[model samples]
Target: MSNSTSETVSFFILGAYLNIGYLRYLYFMITAMLYIVIVVANTSLIVVICVNRSLHEPMYLFLCSLFVNELYGSTGLFPFLLVQILSDIHTVSAPLCFLQIFCLYTYGGVEFSNLAVMSYDRYLAICCPLQYNTRMTSHKALIFIILVWLYCFVKFLIPLSLNIRLTLCGNTINGLYCSNYLVVKLACSDTQVNNIYGVFATALSILVTVLPILFSYMRILRVCFSGSKQTRQKAVSTCTPHLVSLLNFSFGCSFEILQSRFDMSGVPCVLRIILSLYFLIIQPLMNPVMYGLQMSKLRNICKHVLCYKLLAGGRNTVTESCEI
Candidate 1:
């Protein structure tokens, strides 16, 4: 075996610090709080959809899937990030590095795929309301969701396989987390194959996930333009959240991809860190809030649940006092 291949080297993640010392506690507390908010927001939406039988329909089911994807993406990043922010040294073992790469990539892929599927769901509902119920059955929706996740997971594995074999001489990852391109760039040997596969995978994933969203929205737009006033209002109400989510996610992904590929040496480290961590930090918190506040049914259900919890807490407090 090659010496570089066999030799163990610790990877220092130099992206977390801002050169001014003592911000670790500040960063740690802020990140921890953000993580908690993400967990709470996404979980609340998921639980609301799952518990409410009325939300068992295809649209809500797809929404539940999206919330789950947000949670997956956040968990892949925030916990490790919280720890790194608190620790004096930011380092990661090779295996854990690779695992994070897989997770974050999968999270990104599944996110786009879920949004695309949700777009399709919206298209069917608005464009073909009569056929929607028959075509978008629970079984079929489940199948589509499974296929989106499976396809993304399997496709990402190929690039990961190529990455794992390269002999890396360097151990410094430039960004906050284990980015696929950054990891591949650290190789001691030529990474032409990895680079090629990485581009191909990125293009294919974008094509498959984004194209559908665009197509679905275009069709919906056409239908809405031709339909009645009520139809237009309904379409706007239903589609607004999905469109907002798409825009947010796309913006974050674009910044991260650009950060990974381009020369960012001139950019401020603090700005770079924000761009790199944008999707991980913002999108998870954004999606649930967007949907919860915009979608009337979901908002009502969440309010109802919160009120019930408050009343239950009050009853428990009274019972405890009586027992005392």
Candidate 2:
């Protein structure tokens, strides 16, 4: 890369061609298993939502959208990495690399946009209860969903385009996937504009996603504070998932920025692995855990449906015995 031998190194997911050691292979297998479990569980949750007609409410709809985004995002990283690690082929072409970045951004970005949309929905639902039905109509929900994807589509391209023709120079990324920081580090050209634009991108993340969630909670807090103890507890229960997820997301990303600013770029690989693990596993894990466990309605409905399925199976068995 120093122009001595004109050799260029490419950064691809390191899962492929791992170090020649048993421990490294063990790490790869561990991640692979975790990735597979996440994909299956999240995919099943999404399927359950789609198949169950009772979960047609706006709130669940938002959660389903989020789960869908997670499905896409998870597919981009883990499955691909698992394959690379197992097969020992880490090389990815430029187009495939860009595609990976695009897919990840689209998947994750849409989820962020959808969170804001969900927050606004909550605002309207709680703030103007009487008008909730009319305001969040099927037509309106459809329009809003359309807008979320559009906004995400545009927002994703902002960072991606900022790196236009900006080569990664001599470094293949260290991480398992294509990322803004991973890709940008290799550019030999003046990257100030991209960095400044990155600040704007970070601001967009905070302004559009983080701030709205805060605003939603702030409003929820005011409402809950004025209500009875039961009402306060209910509001807290309803908002806890959002709060947890927001903290996970905000803290992870903000740490990245703070660390980078301090010239502390050599963050341990394990930390990065933890951050990645949170999204790949923890976020998906939270969906069913919070919604099914915390919400009385979801729990009740699940119980009823499960009971029905078991009863039906029993009845069918009885009929078969009688026929025999």
Candidate 3:
């Protein structure tokens, strides 16, 4: 009975964040379903990569990294969202808010690095066949992933650790979750230093990810188009999805950054949801399906799972027939 009353209060409080009018309840329920699917799909991909030796290449290696990031990333987000959806007076402590911003930036920056690295790997394999193996050696791969994580860690902690320590004036966080910018807006102290440094860090991350990517694709396009027949087809199949993901994330992210100049505070709640989904909803969900598990190797692994299940079923059927 107490649980029921608590749930009712939660629902009421969470409703304040949604203005769906006649369909508010439906919209909230659908969002919940989307979160569940994201968890299942990404987790499935992570498990497959871990248990399957065949997916140990640098590409899948980076993908597995992404899967892990997505896992924790969802944890940092969805639980709060779930609780918010269930109960009202959704408030977070300042330290917790800072932690949320730090995690979000950390994961997001790491993802940028991961995707960029993956893109560069593909570029080398396609454009420079002879040097691909040498270029993307195990040592090199380890160093690269490590550096990406280090870079993101520094970027995330520096801003948040400093900013969150400052006294906060306005305490209300507009978005459902704590975001870096949102927290900065709450600072009782002037946030200009934080904002400047934060923007610098962000620009550095983007440039690090984008410049090499641009060069890689340029060279890749030149090499692929220079050849003909099967090679061209291979290149398109290999790179098209990467291209789609880059466009999706980069476009939204760039727009998001640009909008910050005008104070992202003014942006409507709905638009914020859309932008958040660009990374959380759109990319993570599509990546396992389009990038990771859709590969021929992953497909074969799926076949293996299915075959094992069928064989088990067949044995059960035969045993039952004999008993009969």
Candidate 4:
């Protein structure tokens, strides 16, 4: 196709239930339920954190931020995906596709940045317990959250804006979601600038986010080794949830980056689709579940909320019966 034709054409999302055959309806039901579960789980955690006065420390605030990010990321992808699953055509307009890429990519960057902030919070609390309160004040924690989001926004927006000007070689996006890397692949022009920007952004993102977590954990590990049994147990209780979250997010992100940057034509189409959606689908669901089960404070708050909700539900039933 001609460059002009390709440039104006909208993208066909070639990965939508590509190998699912007649199970598209079943797939839609399963994903829709999964989406609801994600929504409820993340929302519940966010609400619990917000409502509890005792949970107002930096660590809980960071957990709240992480939950919010999960919800933000999932919302950007799942609604459009559900619609696409039911629709006969799996196409996205060029503008809409680019918009999804921008939103979802921003989500990815912010996720890491938030994790890094959480790691820093843990480091202060564990390794430097005496100064943790004064250093990790509420105001400072809020500033870090704001900066993490702002940095992610400007970082992802630059390349996405640059991408909008590229003349495309094709209109087919080979994956389920709109990936910045995959979109760049379709460009017909010399994408050297875009490629460079992507590399710089990726490297910087890892440095600013993942490296800190690794470093903070290293220090925490050292302290745990030297400290008494009580200290080690305290460290394990507090740090394990964050570590679990980081590992889960890292795994999902690795698969996503790998699939986006590399040629995965040899991979099975079904498996490729699963890998592509892993981060988008799994992280939101997993983070809250992990934290809920692992963190004592959050778990208690959740139990209390569940009990309150159940009591209210039962009261409504009894009141209805009395009126009848």
Q: Pick by lDDT: which candidate is best? A: 1
Question: Relative to the unseen true structure, what is the Cα RMSD of model 4?
Answer: 2.0
Total colliding residue pairs, candidate 2? 2
Ranking 2 against 4 by TM-score, winner: 4
Q: Model 2 Cα displacement at 16 (Å)?
A: 10
lDDT of 1 at 296: 86
Compared with the true structure, model 1 gives a TM-score of 0.93
- Model 3 scores a C-alpha lDDT of 0.71
Per-residue lDDT for 230 in model 1?
A: 95
Candidates arranged by lDDT, highest first? 1, 4, 3, 2
Q: Rate the local accuracy (lDDT) of all candidates.
A: 0.85, 0.68, 0.71, 0.84
Residue 58's C-alpha lDDT in candidate 3?
78
Candidate 1 Cα errors over 4 Å, as ranges: 1-16, 319-324
In model 4, residue pairs whose N, Cα or C atoms come closer than 3 Å (at least 3 residues apart or on different chains), thus clashing, are none
Give the TM-score of each candidate.
0.93, 0.82, 0.84, 0.93
Which is the better candidate, 2 or 3, if ranked by TM-score? 3
**Candidate 1 local lDDT, 176-280, one digit each (tens):** 788888877767778888878867886997699878988998999998889999999999999998888889889998999899989989999889888988987
Q: How far is each candidate from the true structure, as Cα RMSD in Å?
A: 2.5, 3.5, 6.2, 2.0
Q: Which stretches of candidate 3 lie over 4 Å from their true place?
A: 1-16, 19-29, 255-272, 292-294, 313-324
- Winner on lDDT between 1 and 2 is 1
CA error at residue 268 for candidate 2, angstroms: 5.1
- Candidate 2 stretches greater than 4 Å from native: 1-20, 23-29, 87-89, 255-269, 311-324
